[model samples]
Target: MATCKSSSRTGLDSWQSRKSLSECLRHSLENKMFTDVTFKVGREQKCVQAHRLIVSIRSGVFEAMFYGPLAEQDEVVIPEVEHDIFEQFLRYLYTDDVTMDGASVMGLLYVSKKYDVKTLEQKCLAYLSSSMTPDNACVILEQAHVFDEQELKEKALSFILENGYGALKSSGVTDLCHECLVKIIQAEELEVDEQAVFEAVVAWSESACRKQNKDVTDENRRQVIGEVIKHVRFPLLDQKYFAKNVVPTNLLTDAEKVKILTHWICPNENVSPFNANKRTGIIRQEKIIIQRLAGLCGFGCSCSSGADHGIMFSVNQNASLQGFQLYGPYDRPTAHYDARAFITDPTTDDVIEGSSVTKSVSVAAGTTTYDVEFPRPLKLSKDKKYNLLVNINGPKSLYGKSDRSTVQDGSFVCSFFNCQKSKHSNKLNRYTDVDEGQIPGLMFLV
Candidate 1:
C-alpha cells in the first residue's frame, strides 16, 4: 500500500510559478529580446526597441498599428512622448505593473491615454485622485482638462472648492493655462471669499505677465488675466477693504470701483458687472438638538470666563460638524459675548485642528438657542468620541435638559455621555453628568 502524502506546497508552487512567469515577461521586455519593432520617441529622437506581439496583444492602438493598414512600417515615431514614459508604457504591457510618482504619473497617464490602455489609464487616474492635495490640485485640474478626463477634473475641482484658500494660494496655480484658470474662477460653488479670490488672481496675473516677457504692471497683469478677472465678485468684497486695498491696485478702473461701491450701498440696484451671487461653499444640511427642552433649564448652569462646558458624544454615521447651538441668557435682551469654542478628542485629550473658533456671538432675546459656527465644517467620523465645548466671558446663564444617553435623528444615532467641564486646565479633565448641559444641539451636514 503505497500511500501518497498530499503536499501543501502545491498551492505555493503554483503561485511562485505564476509570479515567475510575470518576471520572465518583464525581463524579456527590459532586455529587448527578439524585438521586431523600433520606436523613435521624444524630442531627442531616442530609438527604443520592443516585441510587437506583446504590445499588440495589450493595446488596441498597437494592435491596429501592427496588423491594420499601417502594418507596413516596422518603426513607429512617437515624437510627442518622452523616451522614459514610452518605455514605462511598454513595461506595463509586458508586466501589468508600473511605478508612478508625482513627477512621472502625469507622463505615464499621457502615454496610457495615447496607447488606449484602459487599465493603465484607470490606474493613473486613481493615483492622481489619491495623491491630490491643495498644492497639486491646480496642476491636476489643468492636466485633467488637457486629457479631457471629466471625472478627474471634477474630483480636482471639488477638492479645490472645499479647500479653496489653500489651493488658490498654492504656487502651482500661477502656471495654470487661461482655460483652466477661467474654469476654476467661474465655478459658482467655489468656497473662497471674493477678496481672497481677487488677491490670488492678481498674483496669478503677475506670474503670467512675467512668463510672457511683459512688464509686471497693472495693465499687463489685467491683460494677462483677461476674462478670468471678470469672475471676481467685487461686490462681495467689504466696501472698506475694497476701497483701501483694491482701489490702490488700480486693477479696476474708477468707474468699475464706483459701480461696485454704489452697488454695496444700493444692493437692490444691480449696477456691478461682476456676478453678485454669493458662492455656495458648504451647504448646511441638518441641526441635531441633543436635548429638547421646552424652556431654559436654568438649573444653576452658568458658563463663566475661562471655563470649558459641553457634552461628550459619538455619532453612528459620518457627518460634518458645522456648528453648535448654545442657550442664551434667561430673560435677557440681545447680548453679545466674546466666546471660544472647541471640538476635542476625548480619548487623546487633544483639540481638533481648525475646530477652535473665537468669535463675538450674539444671543437673541429670551431663552433661545444661539448658533456659533466654526470657521469651516470639521468632518466627524462614526463611532468616534468628541467633545464640543464653549468658553464664554462672564457668568452668563445657560440652558439644557435632563441627561440623554442616546439621541436618534434621522439616520444618525448620537450617543451622549457625561458633560465635560474644565475650569482652568486646557485639557478637558473634569466630567459631570449634570441635569443641564450648556451645549443644547449640534449642526451638521450629513
Candidate 2:
C-alpha cells in the first residue's frame, strides 16, 4: 500500500501527470500552484539521473532545523500525493531546509525519494537522524534499503544493531525495521552468517542468564523478544484473522499448554546470588485477560468443590503489555490469582463508582472490549492500582464459539475488584448494581 502512490487525506487531488522530474518541478514551482514543497535534482550513474523533492504541510521550519547542512536524511513517499506531502516537497525547494516537523515528514520525503531527489532526501534524513527512534529510524532506514540509500540505511542499522551486538535478536517487525533489516543484510559479504547470528544471540542470552542466575533456553530467547515487544507495542492486532477449523473434542496439547502457561506465568527463579532463588511470578492474586483472544491467554487448573472440575483459561493483551503475564502452572491444581485490574470499589462494600481503577469502564456486561472506554486516555496510573478476580468458568472463545463453531458457551464468570486502599483515591466509589447498564445476577460485593 505504501509503494502505491496515493494521498491519505481524502477530498484532495493528486499532483498527477507522468511528466519528467524537471518538468513537474518547473511547473509546480514557477506558477506556485504547488509551492509548499522543496525540490532536488542531480545526476548519478551517468545514464540514471536523480531528481528529489519534498512536500509537507510543515516545510518552512524544517528547512531551517539543524546546524548548517544536516547530513543524515531519509526519503518519504506519498504517491500521487496531496498536501500532506507538500511540506517535504517544500524542503527540497532548497538545499538546506531544516525547519520542518521531523516526526511527520516521512511520507513526503518518500515521494522525493521516488523521483530520485537527493538533496531534499538528505535534509529529511538529517532531521530523522537528529531525533531518532526505534520506530522512525527503522522506517527511513528501510527507505534507504529500497532505494540503495547507503548512508541513511547505515544510520538506522547502527541503532538497531547497537546495545552490544544485537544482531540475532528480532527487534520490532515494523515497516521501518523490515526495511532496515533488509538493507543492513543486503549483501552476504556485509553480513554475519546465520550461525554467527545464532552464536551472538546465545552469547547475549548467556550473559543475561548469568546476571540473573537462571536457565536460558530457546524459549528464553523467545521470551526476551516478547519483552521487547511489550515496550514497542504493535498497533496491528486488530487485523482480521481467518478462523481455522478445529474438533470440538480437542484439548490443548502439552506444548501448546506450556506455551500458554509460560506466557501467562512468566515463571522465573531469581538466579540473583544475593536473593533467595524464589519463583519470580507466583503471587496469590487473580487477573483478567481482557485483550488477547478476548481472554484466551489465561490458564488455571481447578478441581475444587464437587464432581466435574474445570480448568479456566483466558488471554488478554491490552494495547500496553501491562495486564499480560503468565498464570499458575498446570502441575499446580486449584491456584489462587490476584491480578491488576479495575473493579468494584476496593474500600467500600457499597456501589461501584465512576473513578474505578480499571483502564476501561463500561455500561454493559457482555460488551465487546472495543466498546469499553477508559475514563481518561488509556494510561497506567501508579497512585491507584486495581485487579480482576475471576473464577475459572473455563475454555471459552473471546466472542464465544471455539474454533469448531461460531457460537460459544465457554466464557468466564469473572468479577472486578478494587485494591486501591490509598488516600488520593477517595473520589472512587464502589461499582455496583445501580451503575448504568449493570447486569442483574452479578453482584458487586463490598
Candidate 3:
C-alpha cells in the first residue's frame, strides 16, 4: 500500500502549478512565444507583440478582430491609442492586472472601454473615482459625462456638492457645463456661505460670457446667471452687506434688487419673501459647549439614579442637532447599564415631549467615551437654553468627573447628588442637591 504524504502536499502541488502557469504566461509575453498579432500604435507607430489566443480569450472585441476576416492579416494598426496604453491593455489580458497612476488611469479607462474589457474598465473607474480631488473633480466629471459613466458621474457630483467651496475655487469649475453648475449651485449641503456661492456663480457667468462672446450687459449677465441665482439664500444676507456687496454686482435686475431691499424693510410688504427659495436655512457647524463644572463631585453612583444628569447649553443659532457627547462613569461596564436623554426648555423648566433618546452601554473594562446619538435631529431654537438630561440605570457602574480649568463661556451643567437619603424603606433615593457649575467634556453636535 502506498502512503499519501498529506492534504497539505496536494495544496502545495496546486500552488506550484498556479505559480508555474503565471511564470510561463509572463515568459511567453516577454519572449513573444507563439506571437500571432502585431499592434502598431503611438504617434511614432511602435509595434507591440501579443498572442491572439490569449487576447481573444480575454476580450470579445479582440476575439472578433483576431478571428474575423481581418485574422488573415498578421498586423493591426491601432494609431488612435498610445503604445504604452496598448501594451498595458495587452499586459492586463495576459496577467489579469494593470499598474496605473492618476494620469495613466484615464487613458487605460478609454482603452478598456474601446476593447470591451469590463473588468479593467471597472478597475479604472474605481481608481479615478477614489483619486478625485478638488483640482481634478470637474475634469473627471466632464469625462464621466462624455463616457456615460453614470456611477462615476454621480460620485463626482456628490464630491462637488460636499466640497463645492474648494472645488469652485479651482480654475476647472469655470469649465463645467451650465447644467453641472446648476446642480452644484442648487446643492443644499454645499459647505460655502451664500456670499461665496453667489461669487462663484458670478465667476461662472463671466466664463460663460467669455465663451459665448457676448457683452456682460444686465440682460445677458442676468440670462447667464438665469434661474441659478434663485437657489441662493439671499434673505440670509445682512441688508447692509447686500447693499455693499450684492447690489453693485449688477447681476440682479433693478426691479429685482428693489424687491429684495424693500422686503428687508417690510417683510410683510408686497415684495418677494426673503426666503423665496424656500430654503431651510444653512445650518452652520458649531460645537455647542457647556463649560465644564469647576470641581469633580466625588459623586459616583449606579445607572439607577432616578434624576438624570447632563449639562445645559444655550444654542444661539437655530441648528440641526445630531447627538450629544457624554463623559461617562469611568472604569468598566456594568450589567443593566442603560443611559437615556431628555430635552427641556430651561426658562419654563418644562420637559419637551418626544425628546427622550436612549442607548444601552456597550461596556469595556475601562473608561469609555460615549457618543450618544439622538433618535432624530432635534431642531433647536435660537437664544434658547436647552437642558439635556441623562438618566442612567445600574449600580456602581456609572461615574462622572468634571474639569473646571477649561471654562467655556456659553454653557453650564447642573450638578445633582442624592441629598436626601430616603428614610422610609419603600422610597428610592433622590438627587436634589443642585450644584450649578461649569461642566466640560460634554458637547452636542450641530
Best of the candidates, lDDT: 1
Which candidate's TM-score is highest?
A: 1
- Taking the tens digit of each residue's C-alpha lDDT, what string does model 1 give over 190-240? 876787789889889888999999999988987888898779988888878
User: Model 1 residue 398 lDDT?
Assistant: 60
TM match of model 1 to true structure: 0.60
Error of 2 at 325 (Å): 15
User: In model 1, which runs have C-alpha deviations exceeding 4 angstroms?
Assistant: 1-19, 36-49, 63-80, 282-446
lDDT, candidate 1, at 116? 92
**lDDT of model 1 at position 345:** 81
What tens digits encode model 2's per-residue C-alpha lDDT throughout 1-446? 01222234334344444556656554444344423223222221111111222322224334433112662233322334455354345435533333567545576567556544566677667777776653355455666677676777677677544311223333322343322333333322322223223333334444555455666655554444332222111111111210121111122234533443343345362211111121111121123333212222233233121112111111221111122222232333233322222333233533233223232122222332222222221222222323322222222212211121111223433322223333322322222111111111111100
Model 2 CA lDDT for position 233: 10
Q: Output the TM-score of candidate 2.
A: 0.27
Q: Is candidate 1 or candidate 3 better by lDDT?
A: 1
Order the candidates by lDDT, highest first — what do you get? 1, 3, 2
- For candidate 3, lDDT tens digit of each residue in 276-376? 44323246555554434344445555445555555555554555455665445544453445766667666666666446678886555554345665543
Clashing pairs in 1: none
Candidate 3 ranges with C-alpha deviation above 4 Å: 1-49, 69-83, 128-142, 206-226, 238-249, 269-281, 284-445
Count the clashes in each prediction.
0, 86, 12
Quality of model 3 by C-alpha lDDT: 0.65
